[model samples]
Target: MRKWLFWLILPLMVGCQLGAPDQNAPLPILGEFEVVNGDTIYHTIRDFSFINQDSQEVNNQTFAGKAYVVDFFFISCPTICPKVKKQMLRLYERFKDEDKLVLLSHTIDTEHDTIPRLKKFATDLGVGLPQWQFVTGVKDSIYGIANDYFSIAQEDPNAPGGFDHSGRLILVDPQRRVRAFCDGTDPKSVDQFMEDVERLLGEMK
Candidate 1:
């Protein structure tokens, strides 16, 4: 009877071990990303180059090996740009120490936001070295990257000084794939945004 009991217990323990998750395997990169009809949205960003606030050439691979948040804004904008920049400032304060996370802000008004202008904006916003990048480039290049990578809306009207865009932050993974997005104007969305970031980073570790 003791032998039969031991055999039964042995099988139960083996079954439990088999059902557990593998500790050595990496976790899935996406746990909260929205899937449409069981298909993940794989994005291909357009290749481009721009000058950052520090006058460094930033390109497609600038975000490699890290998860960075991106947004588009012009320093002269009187409306949502200030609010968005302030909110992004808060975000930078939270993750500034984490070398794996960074922030990139591209200017939509390339004609005016030159390297010096971008540098001044960064200084006014208190952006630190290697932590934040304010980028500007040819008018069409900046606009193209905004639409392609972030899926944000942007239209340049023929009217003088006329342009429209959406206020949204894009989260991109180390592989240049868009992972998540959030409305920059909404404070609640920032909370949810960080939650997803944590989830994604945890998977990579």
Candidate 2:
């Protein structure tokens, strides 16, 4: 769980297909993370579980052994969720066939966004199995996972939409390490996310 430990384990856990990027690549430099300050690479997202649309249990290992993009948003969110989800949908469309790239959207407002609600949301978005997961669970569990692992999600009473937060898309590698973080709202940011995914996947080769 420590930084150095994660760095030490990264190479062993990552598949041989992922090699470091070449000199001319456009992806963000991977080893320059210390310069980014708060953006960290995690070994695991602990103590969290949520039911998928099929009523099956899903846990941290759900994202193990691949490059995954994650976000926290409730379906009823009036402002950022809609825009954030649009980017997520774009991400899903971009890599739906790239079996190693996965997507997870978590609902911050658990009381309103139940498992059934998540099912409906994913259904409306036309997301099929084995590509994306729309998740909701206990309020504290959801909030804790967001705050501790992804460093996004907050609660506010007077903010524009009753909650104050950022539109962040988190990138995690096969070993559950945070590789890159992007602003989910901007087109270029999403493009950068895609480029990063490619870089990680390229490293796999």
Candidate 3:
């Protein structure tokens, strides 16, 4: 969908509360964007390979049959990222043990967020193991992949921390299609998104 159309539909589709009738609402499948039989087609998260905080290679195959949440950030970000991380912490604490769920926090500043830095960042967050991962890798590839997920991460001299990026937490289903997203800077929205997460997990089962 076009960017303007996306924002128009997003609000209407999100905010599903667990106890409400809309709790069972289906998540939207993002980006119908491919060419097949002389026509356009929908798209999904394409293949990618990057290094996680653990220094292990992570790719689409790594998340096969699993649903995951993703966000872009840099450790030294002076604005927005910390707030986003705070909410991400809430998610990590709650769903860390869910067998089918995982969180991929990718850094926009890949040049500076090395394995050691990400490892320390993960430590500082008090989340780890099979649940959460702070990833950093080739800058261009990371930026391009972020766009593929319908998120943004690019350098900006005028922006704080020298980077401009979206503060949205994206949800992807087992099939690698974007299911939902929320403003990571808002705690209330994250709370509602938490409910959506639970509902999605239950739906997948």
**How high is the CA lDDT of each candidate model?**
0.70, 0.70, 0.84
Residue 9 CA error for candidate 3 (Å)?
Answer: 5.1
Off by over 4 Å in 1: 1-41, 153-161
TM-score of each: 0.75, 0.77, 0.88
lDDT of 3 by residue, 67-176 (tens): 99999999999999999999999999899889899999999998788899999999888888679877887899899989777788999999999999999998898888
Looking at candidate 3, the ten consecutive residues that score lowest on lDDT are 12-21
RMSD (Å) per prediction: 14.2, 7.7, 3.0
Checking candidate 2 for backbone clashes, the offending pairs are 17-204, 17-205, 18-203, 18-204, 18-205, 19-203
TM-score of 1: 0.75
Whole-structure CA lDDT of model 2:
0.70
Whose lDDT is higher: candidate 1's or candidate 3's?
3
Residue 144 of candidate 1: its Cα lDDT? Answer: 75
Best-performing candidate as measured by TM-score = 3
Off by over 4 Å in 3: 1-21, 33-41
Q: What value of lDDT does candidate 3 attain over all alpha carbons?
A: 0.84
